[model samples]
Target: MKGIKFDGNHSYDAYQLFLNSYSIGEAEPNTNLVEIPGVDGAVDFTEYFGGVTYKSRILKMQFTFIADRFGLNAAYAKLQNALNGRRVKIVLDDDREYFYTGRVSVGALSPDGQIGEVTLTATCDPYKYKTKVRTATCYGHTVGKGVGTVDSPTVTLIHASVTNTGGAPAVPTFNGDKAFYVTATERHAGGSSDTFLNESESLPSGKDTAISGVEIPAGATQEFGFCCVGEGDLTVTIKLQERSL
Candidate 1:
């Protein structure tokens, strides 16, 4: 863990500093650098005219303790052993350059005597990089529209190259190289009868708000979002789960 030469005042070498400064989580040994920002004499190119932005994909992996009761039993112990300390890997497409060697903790455990909904927060490594995000457009076709309550303007759409940007998804797999998995389709206050809506999903895994699906109704901003690292001929189709509502 030593070799690079430093000028002065820098506590550690750039490599060491970089590793400590940014976290890819213990489970993920490392993360793909989206961009270097100011390195290599790279200028600030923020748009299509400036240049193109290709960002590293941020992915999430989840584990659950599906026990019917509280701990102190073989079940709880089994759950602990399953994910108490585990390494997770996020694979990048094409080049095979990916991140790996991270761990999981039971820290998301709920408190005792807490019945019903006991939700614990699972904290993983925050993702950081200096890459660009490519801008792409997905197609959408309505399935169940003009239905539901008059007050509630709901439109169930299959994953039609377009669905949502962010939602409280329990899984962490992408639809393709640039799309996350689509979920239960419902209504959206998307601009008029026929048009595209602007939806924004979470950026990678560590920088802002954690939002479940948006409550599409009056007074809501149409969002803009895309899937994670989806590969191949990316085609999205989201169907409304009748069992849901």
Candidate 2:
């Protein structure tokens, strides 16, 4: 069953939309060129500095909508109401483990009685993100690897619990580089099961200022080390989404 899932809803299952054919565009790199006065050629910033930027990719699909009891017009209306002009999480049947975030444009519906044909064009982000988020938990020190073609800039500190065994406060670091402090009010009391991550509100004051997060390079193992200003026991968990071209 070859089909497309938009925003976690399957096209075929929800609307009886059958995918006839599909095509994916190439991951074209965007060029950075600077024109200089009296220079023969434009200065290529991307080529000289080895930095690459990508434009949005396109995914086109041809689909046939089969109407049941409601009719073709009803089916078309339902499909339009669900997808048109909306940003969606696109998951193809061929690759269920990865997803692309994009906006879908539905073409005009051409109908022959109960059946109709239409085209869908998705303008997606350059990278295909892994569905599963990778998590690494450590008591004091641990190693974790990022699995993708590009480095992930948004790493989240999902959980942290620190107890100062010594006289001073403790600070934990992600990848032994970026440091975030734990306040006395935010310390774990060892009785409650509350979590700080994924909360609706912003992080506590002072805790959000220090930790800027770390960049995890693709396919490289990075060490996460936690050190206390005095002596303390710390447990922290971090998560990241890996993406590739």
Candidate 3:
């Protein structure tokens, strides 16, 4: 009954394949070391280059494909077609709440009578992403909680509507850092059904649209609201995914 789901296709149901064994490779650190002329050990430049970087993780799975209604050759072909060179989301039966994204390489399939054993190696990203995407609604200066072992870099803003009550423009802030600016023309009046005008528009001049410096830290509650040059009220929804090593 133990199997893997690759790109939304169940291995057992699709190819009559069952997981026999598996192994996960640890994330290797990407370090820079300099060998000195007479030093006992190499000088580590990992900290100098903004801390340690992580290489891609590896997941190896051994599966036994039992020929049922379909012949062994047909089933093996199906499995090859599904995973050969495709980058997909891989979800193991043991960890249903997290998924790894990578390209699966199908190894040699050794056939014995009606069964064939195959090895699958997945070169995955360093982190596993949560299956569920969490949402946080912000009303003015609202705070939201983050749950994960690592910080998430992807944050999306949606259903954003702003009302500028003061004379100056309002800029959205996440953890006291500027996100984007809202001009007077983009503001919605009180009781207006129209959303903010700059929902999908690019940021103001010299501002990047990609949200940065606003990552949700692991197990921390951060404030995500607006700071006005005068006064403003903003209503928006934030969506993000939690990731871990």
Q: Which pairs of residues collide in candidate 3?
A: none
- Scanning candidate 1 in windows of ten residues, the lowest lDDT window is 236-245
List the global CA lDDT of all models: 0.29, 0.59, 0.59
The candidate that achieves the highest TM-score relative to the unseen native structure: 3
Higher-ranked by lDDT: 1 or 3: 3
TM-score of each: 0.20, 0.64, 0.65
RMSD of 1: 20.2
Q: Write the per-residue lDDT of candidate 2 for residues 1-245, one digit (tens) a residue.
A: 67999988898999889999998888798888899999999988875654476899999989998675448888888999999888999999998877889999989998866678999899999878763222233343322212221212332223432222222122333332223222212333674232222122222322322244333445543333222222223333433455677
Q: Tell me the tens digit of each residue's lDDT in model 3 across 1-245.
A: 77999988888888788889988899898888999998999998986956356899999999998785347778878888889888999998899877899999988878887688889999999877762222233345422212321112232222332222222222333222233332222223563222222333323322323253333445533333222221223332333455677
For every candidate, C-alpha RMSD to the true structure in Å: 20.2, 13.1, 12.5
Ranking of predictions according to lDDT = 2, 3, 1
Q: For candidate 3, which ten residues in a row score worst on lDDT?
A: 143-152
Better of 1 and 3 by TM-score: 3
Model 1, 197: alpha-carbon shift in Å? 49
